[model samples]
Each structure stands twice: as C-alpha cells, then as structure tokens.
Target: MKKRFARFKSGWSLNRIFHDVTGALFAPLLISLPVWADAQPIQTLTIMEYRAHLNSDQPTVRGMIKFADLVSEGSNGRLAVTVSGATVPGSPEDQIKALQEGGPHAPDMMLLVTPALRHVEPEFEIMDLPFVVHSDRQAHELLDGPVGRELMSRLESHGLVGLAWWENGFRQITTSGKSFIHATDLTDRPVRVIPEPAFVETFKALGATVVSLPYPQLYQALKSGRAEAQDNFASQILVGHLYDVQSTMTVTNHSYSAIAVVANSAVWRRLSVRDRNVLQHAAIEAGRYERDLIREQAKTDSAELAHHGMTVHSLSPTELARMEAMTEPVRQQFFRSYDPKILDLYRHQIGTRWITR
Candidate 1:
C-alpha cells in the first residue's frame, strides 16, 4: 500500500488544514473514552531525545515533559514516562535501534527527526523535499489530515507507532563566514548535512561540498574547519551555541525539519485502550504546544544570534525563489518517490493553501 506525508517547515510531514484553535479546543475531547479496563499494572516508559539537556530547554523537550505529565494524570498514575535527552549511554542511532528491537530493551517512545524516521520508512522521505511546504499551516493540514495518518501507518512495518508530530521549526542555514543568499555562494563550501539522502542531495544541488554527521559532531566539524556550514532552527543555533562555530545565519527556510513522537508498536499494543487514548491524545496536545513555543522562541533567538556577532539574514522573495530553483532537481527526484494519489493530495492541499495566501 502507498504511504503518505505532508510537507512542513517546522521539521515535518504534514499539510495543515485545520484551525490552530480547533486543535487546542478539541484535542482533549477527542481522546476522552469510556473506561474499559478495571485493572492494569503501573508501567514506566522511557522517552529519548537527540540533544543533551541544555541550560535552557527547547519546546520540544518541554512538550515531552508535558506528555509525560498528561499521561500520568490521565492514567491516574498507572502510566509514568521517564525522559532521557543525554548522549552518554548511546547516540540517537543506537536509541532508535533499541526502540525498533522493542522487547525488554527498547524505549517506549522516542522524539526523532523526520529525516531520522526516513531511515526506517523510505516513504517518509516524501516530506523531506525542499521548498514543498510554504508555511507551517500547510504542514499541519497535511499531517493532521489523511496524509499524516497514512504515513503513521507505515511505522507499523518498522515496529513503531507514530503518535504525533512535533516541531523543530523551519531550518535556517549557517556558515563560518560566507553566507548563501544565493546558490552560487555555496561554491566549494563544506556544508554539514543531516545524515539523510534528501539533505545531502539538496545541498549538493545548491553547490556545496556536503558532509553528513551526527548532531553531536556538528560543532567540532565547524570549529575545526572540517565543515563551514549547516542548517537547523534558530533556537538550535542559540541553545546549541552554533553561532560560535558558524558566524553567519541565513533564513533559508529551505526545508522542514520535523521530529515525530513514536512508540514501539509492541509496547503500544500492550497498553489498555483508555491508556492508549490518553497517551496519544497527550502527545498531540503537547506537540501543538511545542510548535507554538518553538515559533515564539525563534523570534528572540534570531536577535540574540545577531547580538552574539553572527550575521543573521532573512530571505526576500527573490532569494527564496532562487533557492527553490537551485533545489528543483532534488525535489523532482523525491517527487517520483510518492504514489500518484499522494502527489495529487499534496497538490490540492498545498495549492489550495497557496491560493488562499
């Protein structure tokens, strides 16, 4: 069967069709279900995130905390969630492998980048195409709509259950000194890309010498001059202190970088009906909250980046158009990766949103 996803700038696969207020108002109600379980053992689930605990918590981290709280409350403490964001025990890759294994050794849930999920389900890469999603609104429609449900269904094949989409926000570009306002600026630049085909291919099309690396290794790559450029949300630049590594920030907003909150299918299936509703509902609500927080934080973080001596540039329509032109080939390559039905849905969703804009 064909899988699906929505293109989102906030790190995602979605098409935003519903009103923001609708999500906020009805989310709790949607999860409310008739109590069916009389007895259930208390269970503690581990939640893993890629970044270590920073001085300031990102909204994504905050959302995980919120999810944990709601689950405990809704389950009347029968379900407890423990969160781990540190890198000491293992890398994100290791954690993902563990979750996929899903016996006694796996995390119950993990918040992962959309690109990272692509490794398990290649169909997910459909949402990784650059410039496909024009705004966060469109992303929400795609994800919350049928397209997202289809993509989440694909997770079953990989031993995962996608709970909800969270935000990493629109990725911006950073360079050591040279800025890529236009494609030509990338000539000979060694850009650090997420370890994903879409990222590598996109940067190459824009004329960069690309290197793939783990998030932990990015700062050193820039500091040691092994790499001079990378992309991430503005908040990441501030919290990760990437400004110290790359002195220039351009609001390329080229592609979306989304993280998914997913559970091991085995664990999820073992949950009581009411508990499943509680956890999934809590995850969706937390995701919306996290997305809002990330958007708010980006405003202040960009200014802080400028104060910290990093040149921050927001793209004009002309330059954004240029970027789309440069990355056209990469988009085409991914366009054929989806079923015709998925593409048709994308066109109607994105095209409608575009006309309204």
Candidate 2:
C-alpha cells in the first residue's frame, strides 16, 4: 500500500482527503473516535519564551505581551496568558512538540523562529534567501500578501498550523575576527548558520564554510573560536548579549527572521469557530505590535551596539550587489524543489508590488 501510494505525486493522501468521510462511513461497524473534552476554563494561556540567556526583553517577548492583552480583552477575561519564560521548553522543536501534545504540558500556541519550523515547512525558506527582502516595508508586503498565505498553507501538510506572522527583524552578519565588507571576505571562514537549508546554501555560495547550529549555542561557538561569525536580527544580538563577544556588525539583510504563531492541528480542530476567531484576531494584533517594536528599535539598537564599541558597517551598493548575487543559486535551487504554485505566487505578487513602486 505504501509503495502504491508513493507513486501518486501531488495526489492527496487517502487519510487527508477522507478523514471525516471514512469515519462517517465506518460509524456503524466500529466505536467512535473519542471526542475532546470541553476546553478548560481559559483563565491562563501559556507561551514558552527562549529568553533565559538574555537579560532584557526581546521583540518576540514584547509581541507575546501584546498578544496576551489582545486575547484577554477580546475574550473579555475568559482567556488570559500565562507566560512561562524559558520554563516551558528548552528548544523550538521541543516547544512545537509540547503544542502537539495539548494537555497539562501543552501550549495552545508556540512562537517559532523560521529555522525550527523549516524542517516541517521548507518552502518558507523563500523569505530566508539572503538579501531577498531589503526593508521592513518589503518584509511586510511579503508576509501579509498572497505569497505569505501560500507559504502558510504548507504548515498543515507538516502537522503544524500557522495562525499569524510576527516579526523578529532582518538578520545582520557579525564576526569577531574580521569585518564582512565584500562577498569574497566570507571565503575560508566558518560561519554559524541557522539549521535551515536555505541559510546553509546562502553561506556556501558566498565561499564560506557553513556550520549548521541552533540559536542557543551560537554565542559560545563564537567565543571559543569554533566559529567566526553568525547571522541574526539586531534584537537577538542585543537581547542575547552577543555583542559582548563579537566585535563587528554588518548590515547584511541576509534573511528575514520572523516568528509564526502556530497551533497543533489536533488542538485547533477541537476549538469552536468563535474561539478560533478570537485567537486569529489576537495573533494579528500581536503581529502588528511586533512589527512596530522591531522597526522602531532596530536603528536605535544598531547605534547602541556601536556605542558599546562594536564596529558597524553598512555595505556599499556594489558590495550589496555582490552579496545579492551569491543568493541567486539558492533561489533557483529552492524554486526547483518547491511547489510550482508557491513559486509563481511569489513571483507574480512580489513582482507586481515592485513594478507599481
């Protein structure tokens, strides 16, 4: 049966196509599937924060706060958030699993940075391409437009469902040993890259030896000289306090690092449509709050990092062109491997928006 089903490329799996249909057809012959219990009094909602290592609140945390308030106000106090800062789960993957379980140890939603979710939803790497999105406004256009919705739909196939988009700001490249002024400057250096394939490809194309690592270990890798540079948003470097060890911050815009508020499908299916609407609105409110905080803080954060003796470099247009060219291969590779509709959607919409401008 597995072999036969594997032959049908692009065909919907029987289980997916007829989950309810089969249940109804077989009702007479078998016991019914267990119905989920009524939602417990929604006194508190838990959000897992990865902020134990950082001293100050990051944009992601700020977004969570806004989301909680929106939910409480929208639900009129029936739903409230219980923020479990670094207490709920250790890693993004662990947090995702916790949401899937949906019980005493579960969260109704988990905020995941793109890399962690990339394994489950690789097509999202569209935005992860180096220098693909140049500004906050461009990022917003992509996320809220048709391309973003098309990418979000892939979450269901991977067992997670996307609720709303949140910002983490654009990634900047930083190195302790050297400054990245040109694409060739990356040659022969071991750069710490997010574990996502697109990131790995981007670095490799620029002539760097890419090391795939999780976010939690990156600063140590730099401090110990095991790696020379890393890429992340300004908020992460500041909140994670990576500037203490790294000396140079380059405005690379290598990728857009955003968070997705996602729910496990099983948990979502049990909620009433009314509850779902509340969740959706809360998520949008949180996303807006996050975007505003990031846009307002990034320039200030860069200046502050410089005040602390970290050398900052904004690339010239020629150098920026070099960096952008390095990512073309990654773009081609991704489009080849991803769904054609997803590729076309992005091209058409992103192109249309560009032309109008």
Candidate 3:
C-alpha cells in the first residue's frame, strides 16, 4: 500500500500542477495584450471659414490651411485636421452661431472678425472704434498684446477659444463714381456700411446716407445703384472683383479689421496637453504667416487696382488727422455702448487723448 501511494505522489508533482493552474488563469490576459498594445483610434478636427477655397491666394484661408498642416504633423497620425473654407453659406454670423452651440453642426475651428464677437459681447466694439490704431504694428500689438489677451480670455465664457489674430488689413473706402481724396467726398454719398451700429454711425457722422447691406449683396448694390461706395480692405475688393465695378479706391483706413482664429472651447479643453500645445503653437505660427503675407498683398492689390484703372488714393497726414477729428464724436459713443473700463483700456492702447466720462 505504501509503495502504491509513493508511485501516485511521484506521478503528480505539486509545483508542476501549480504552474499549470497559474498559466491557465493568466492565458486569456496574455493573449489579449496585443489588443491593449495597439494604437488608439485617430481623432479628427474640422475648421470652417467663410473664405478660403473662394480665393486660395487670400492669406486668411491660406494661413488656416497651413495651420491645419502644422497640427497634423505635430500630432503624428493620432490627430487629423480638415479645413473647410467657404463651406458654410450665408453670413459669418451663421457659422458663428454653430460655434457658440457646438456639436455636429459646429466646426472645431474657424476664422472670425471682431464684430461677430461684438454681437456676442459688446465690449468688442472698443476695437471697432474708427482709427483705433494708427499703424499695422499698433494693430498687431493691440490685438496680440494685453488688450487682445484680455478680450480673448473673455471668450472662454462664450464657448469660444480665441487663438490669435490674423489680418484683414485696414478698412478703406471704395467709390463707384468719385475718388475719395478728401473727407467731404464721403459727405452725403450713398455709401454701403456693414450691418453694425458703429459702421452705420461712422458713415452717418461723415454726413453720408448709410446704405446698410450684407457683404454678399454689396457688389449688386453698387451695380444696381442701391449703393455708390463701400468701405473695406483691398482683399475684399479683389474678392468681389469690385475693381471691375468700382472706379476709385481711397486709402481712408477709417477703421481696422481682423480675422481671429477661434476654436470650440469645450472641444479645446478636451484636448490632451500635448495636443493643446501643438494646436496653439500652430495657430500662433499661422497667424504670423497671415499677418506678414497680408502686408505684401495689400501693396500688391493696390498696384493691381491701379492697373485695373481704379484710382488708388492715400490719406495725407493732415487729411487723416482731420478725418479722425471729424469722427471723434462717433468714437465717444463707445462709452454708451460698452463697458467704460474697456473704453479706458482701448483709449490707453490707441493713445486717444480724449477722455471718456
């Protein structure tokens, strides 16, 4: 009986049995490791803009495309970027609504102007005040500097992440029949103004009958004689082929305009630290690219407009000063429309000597 028992014990070693049991328990986990070790699914982000594919030469669209490229490269294959320029129809306000709500309808990003935000937060009108900044450097510094940063910070509450500012250049007046070499040329003229109160008021202050119209309808308004003149940048004039219809270009620079690259704040916050860094760095780099490109393009467009037989007029220092003085009363309206605190900041930044109560 002892010999039989010894044979049975030798047949079943405890360590061998334990090894078999442990291996069986962990077999499923070990076999499933390849699934865990595989790369994660890629995430995609879309950028919607009013202009891009319309005229790929335009810096606003080109810079945004470059931004998309930088982000894709920076994120490796883990992230993908889709730039849909000129995708959304209607006014920029329409796309802006999608941004504020965020979802399938809202794109992950887009380029916008101050007025779009002004409608959401009236403090933005501070920047819209005519002749708020004198030089290109001043505009860049104001929009990229402390004031810009503060304005951008406020966007967080509005479900937007204001990344950086791109240039739309200065807003100049274009006339269909007369050249605007002097401020009086604008007086009583039927000039088309954007659908903003400041624009309406500025033209009204110039003694012109304001022809309020959406951007899309401006060229037709000029052709049909509903409007005789409009104020905007060179790119826009070229965008609408207005030189073909408009006879003169006045470099009044009555107001400044910008294109800000903003993202859906909720989506922005969900990005990983590395991803956020990549996106932010890309945005800043792209903004600089657009700003520099527009500087050269503005010069080229003016020359091209002259080639097209449209007279390009520059404002003399004296003329500009007179215009600024003429518009001073309208600038003061900021006190009644926006926060007095922001008005003080804008006045300080723009070096406007007039004090607002």
| TM, every model | 0.83, 0.82, 0.85
Give the per-residue lDDT digits (tens) of candidate 2, residues 251-278: 8776887678887787677777877788
Considering only N, C-alpha and C atoms within 3 Å, which residue pairs clash in candidate 2? 45-82
lDDT of 2 at 122: 72
lDDT digits (tens) for residues 18-126 of candidate 3: 1111111111110001112127766677775544224445676568667766776687746666655334445657767777777775578877788877867777766
Which stretches of candidate 3 lie above 4 Å from their native place?
A: 1-38, 352-354
Mark the regions of model 1 whose C-alpha exceeds 4 Å error after superposition.
Answer: 1-41, 53-56, 87-93, 352-357
lDDT of each: 0.72, 0.70, 0.73
Candidate 3: global Cα-lDDT? 0.73
> Candidate 1, residues 59-116: lDDT per residue as tens digits?
8756776777778778886777765443223545565687778665456788877776
Summed over model 2, clashes come to 1
Question: Which is superior by TM-score, 1 or 3?
Answer: 3
| Rank by lDDT (best first) | 3, 1, 2
Better of 2 and 3 by TM-score: 3
- Counting clashing residue pairs in each candidate, in order, gives 18, 1, 0
| Weakest lDDT window of 10 consecutive positions for candidate 2 | 18-27
